[model samples]
Target: MEFFNKTGKVAVGSRLRMLTEKITEDAAKIYEVYGIGLQPKWFPVFYVLSAGEEKTITAIAKEIGHSHPSVSKIIAEMGKKGLVAEQKDKTDGRRNMVSLTPKGKEITIKLQDQLLDVNAAIEAISAQTTHDLWKAIEEWEYLLEQQSLLSRVVEAHKKREAAKVTIVDYQPKYKAAFKALNEEWISTWFKMEATDYKSLDHPEEYILDRGGHIFVALYNDEPLGVCALVKMDDPDYDYELAKMAVSPKAQGKSIGWLLGQAIIEKAKQLGAKNIYLESNTILKPAISLYNKLGFKKVPGRPTPYERANIQMELDLRS
Candidate 1:
C-alpha cells in the first residue's frame, strides 16, 4: 500500500504482482490448515499429471502456461518429495515424460474435498465485489491480444514523430536525402535519365543557384521527401514543380501531400503565375493528387525524359 502511495496507479505490473503474492500467501495458509505440505504453485503440475496420462516437460509447460525451465524446477522439487516421477520418453529419448506417483495420487484424493471449501471462500470474497476479477482479467487478455502494449507504445511514438514533420528549405546536409527520396520512386518507375542525374546529384547548382527553390519534408529532423520549384527562362511568374518524391517508408503518413502543399505555397509567395509538372499517366496516385491540387491536363511539351507522357499545369493567377 505504501508502494502504491509512492508510485500512484500507473504502476500496473507492481500492483498485479502484489495481488498475486497476497493470493499465493493465502493459498499457502489454507494448505497448512489442511496439514498438506504441498505448495500452492505445485498444484498446476500435480493436477495436470493427475489426468492419468504421462506428459513430457514441454507438454506440461504448454498446458500450465509456464516456462519449461520453471516447470522442470518444480518437477525436480516434487520428485524429491516423492510426489512425481520422470521416465525417458519411449519414442523420443531426449524428452522426459512425467507422471504423478502413488503418494501424489493419494494427496490429490485427500485435497479433492478441501478444494470445495477453498472455492467457496474465494467465491465469497468475489461476491463482496462489484466486478468479477476473473472476467476483467479475461477481457484485459483479449485486448492485449488484439494489440500488444509494445505495439501501442510504438504507434504512439510514430504519431509523435510524424506530428513533428516540418517543410524546410534545402540545406547542404539534406542533399543526400533529397537525391535518395527522388531516386527511390523515379528508378522504380522509370530509368533515371541524364537530366534526372544532373538535378539529383547537384541540386544547388541545377535548382537552387538557377533562381529556383527546393523544399525538404522532415520528420523529427530527418528528411523524408523533397520538392523543387524550378524557375523558367521566359518569365519570373512561370515555374516548374519537379523532382518531387517521398520515401516509401513514409508513404502512408502523407509526406507527399505535405511536400506538395508546401511547394505550392512557396510558389504563390514567390509570384508564380503558372506552375507546371511532367509525370506519367501510369502514376495514378500522383496524378490524382495533382488533379486534386487544381492541376489540369495541358498540351504535352517537349521533355528530356522518355517517361513524360502526362503534362499538367496549375494556374495561380485565378
Candidate 2:
C-alpha cells in the first residue's frame, strides 16, 4: 500500500486491481453475513441467469461480458451445487441453454432484503466521495476507447525520447561523429567523392570558415545526427543543405527532421532566399523527408560528384 501510494498515477493499473480485490473480498464477507454460500466470482453469471431468461451459454457469456469458458466454468460449479441446470434449446437442439435451478431461485427470493440494504450502503459510500467512481470509470473507458492507453503511452515515450535530443552548434569534438554518421549513409548508397571527404574531414575550413553553420543533434552528450548549411558560392542560392544523416540508433526518433528544420531556420536567419541540395532518387526516405521539409525538385546543375542526379531547392521566401 505504501509503495502504491508513493507511485500514485504510475501504478494506476496495479492500484485498480488491488482495489478490485479488496472490493471482492468485502463482497464475499457481505454475502456470508447474509447467510449465503455463493462465491463472489460467480455473481455476474448468477445475476444473468436469475433474470428468468433461459439463454444459450454463448448468449449468457455475451450478456455478462465474460468469456464463454469462464461462464461455462461458473455454470459447472453451480450445477455441482444444484444451483443451475442446462437443457437443449427447443428451437435449436444444438444450443445448450441455461437457467437457475430451484435452489438458485430460492436464493434470489431471499436476496431481495439484502439487495436493498446493499444498495443503500453503496449510495451512502458514494455520497462520501468528492467524485463519483462510477461516472469516472465510464468516462475513462470512453476516452480509452477513443485513443487507447497503448497509443497515448507510445506518444508520450516518443515525446520524452525526442526531448532528450538537443540540437547544438557543431564543435570540433563532434567532428568524428558528424563525419561517421554522414559517411555511413553515403557509403550505403554510393561511394564517397573527394568533395565529400574534403568537407567531412575539414569542416571548419570548407564550411564554417565560409560563413556556413553546422548543427549536431546530440543525445546524452553524444552526437546522433548532423547537417550543414554550407555557404554557397552559386549565383542562384545562398546555402547548400548538405550531408544530412542520422545514426541508426536514432532512427524513428525524428532526428533527421529536427536537424533539417534547424538547418532551414538557420538558412532563413542568414537572409537566404533559397536553399539547394543534391541527391539521388534511390534514397526514398531521405527524399520524402526533404520533400516534407518543403524542398522541391529543380533542374540539375553541374555537380562535382558522379552520384548527383536529382537537384532540389527550397524557396525560403515562400
Candidate 3:
C-alpha cells in the first residue's frame, strides 16, 4: 500500500485548520448548554476580563482578534445584557475601561468550572488524547494570532457584504434560464462538481417535504439565479437562505442581487424576523453580496460547502 507524500507548513496548517471550526462549535454548544451566559463572540472578552485588568476597548480589540467597532458593539450589547459594565478610566479621562460586572464575574466563574469539567472529561477519557487536543488547539490559536485571523475574517466578511444580492419571487417559467445559468457558472467560475448544479425534481419536496422555500430571479423568461429559504429546527432562529447560485454567463448583471431581495421579501412575507445564509470566503463575491445586504460578522466556525464557506444573517422587523 503506497501513500502519497506530503510536507510543508501550508499542508500542516490546512489540516489543523479543519479542527478550528469543529472545536469552536463544540465549545460553544457546551457553554450554551451549561448556561454559561456568554456567546462564542464574547469568548475573547471573557479571556481579557479573566486577566484581572481593566482594559480599554482599543486595547481589548487589539489583544483580541476583532475590529474596534465589532468589539465595541459586542461590549455594548453585553453591558445591556448585564454581563459587563463600563466606567471612565480615572487616570485617563478619555479612556473608558470595560470590566465584568458582579453578574458577569459570577457567570465567568461558572464558565471556568464548566471549562475545567470539560477538560477533566477529556482527560478522563484518555490523558494522551487530552494533551494532544490541547496542543493542537494551542497551535491553531497561535497561527490565528500571528495571521490576525480576526482581521482576515473581518475582511472576508466585508467581501461577502459587498456582494449583496437582492431577491425576488416569481413563477417557475420565469426561471427557465436557471439550468443554463448554473451550467455556465459551474463550468467557468467555480469549476464545481457536477452534482452542484443538478436540478430539483421535486419542487414541492423543497416547499412542503421539509422546511423550505423557493425563489427565482427572472430576466423575462430567463432564470438568471436561484436561492432557497430553509427552515431550521431552532424556533428562536428564523429561516436560512441556502442553495444560492447564479448563471456563469450572467455573473456581472446583478441577478444574484435580485434573488437576495426576493428571499428577504419572501421571508418577511412568512413572518420571519431573521434570515441567514450559508457560504464560504473563497467565493469572495458571494460574501460581498451578503455584507452589502446588511449581514453582520458573527464568530462562527463554518463548515465547507460547494459554493460558499460563510454564514450570514439579516434581521427584519416585521
Query: lDDT per model, in order?
Result: 0.88, 0.91, 0.70
Q: Which predicted model would earn the best TM-score?
A: 2
Candidates sorted on lDDT, descending? 2, 1, 3
The lowest-lDDT stretch of 10 consecutive residues in candidate 3 is: 1-10
Badly placed stretches (over 4 Å) of model 3 are 1-180, 183-201, 207-211, 301-308
Q: What are the per-residue Cα lDDT tens digits for candidate 3 across 1-318?
A: 011134544355565666677777887888878987677778888779876688899999899868999999999989988988889999988989999888887886777778789879878867655357667779978898788766776666645643554344535664444445545655565665544434343444444347567777655545567877778666656888766777665555576676777778778888898987666676778788888877765656544446654567788973
So what's the TM-score on candidate 1?
0.60
Model 2 worst lDDT window (10 residues): 248-257
Per-candidate TM-scores read 0.60, 0.63, 0.40
The digit string of per-residue lDDT tens for model 1 on 1-318 reads: 787889896698889998999999999998888877799899999889988899998999999899999999999999999999999989989988999899988888888878989899889989999999989999989999999988877777666666778999999998998888888898898888999999999998999999899999987777888899998785433889999887777755667777888888988999889899999999998998899888999987778889999888999989
Worst 10 residues of 1 by lDDT: 248-257
TM-score ranking, best first: 2, 1, 3
Best by lDDT: 2
Give the TM-score comparing model 2 with the true structure, all chains together. 0.63
**Per-residue alpha-carbon lDDT of candidate 2 for residues 1-318, written as tens digits (9 for 90 to 100):** 789778889889988998999999999998889987788998888888889889887888898788999989999998999999999889989989899998999999887778899899989999999999999999999999899999999888877888889999999999999899989989988899999999999999999999999999988878999999999888898999998998888876778889999999888888999999998999898899999999999998899989989999999998
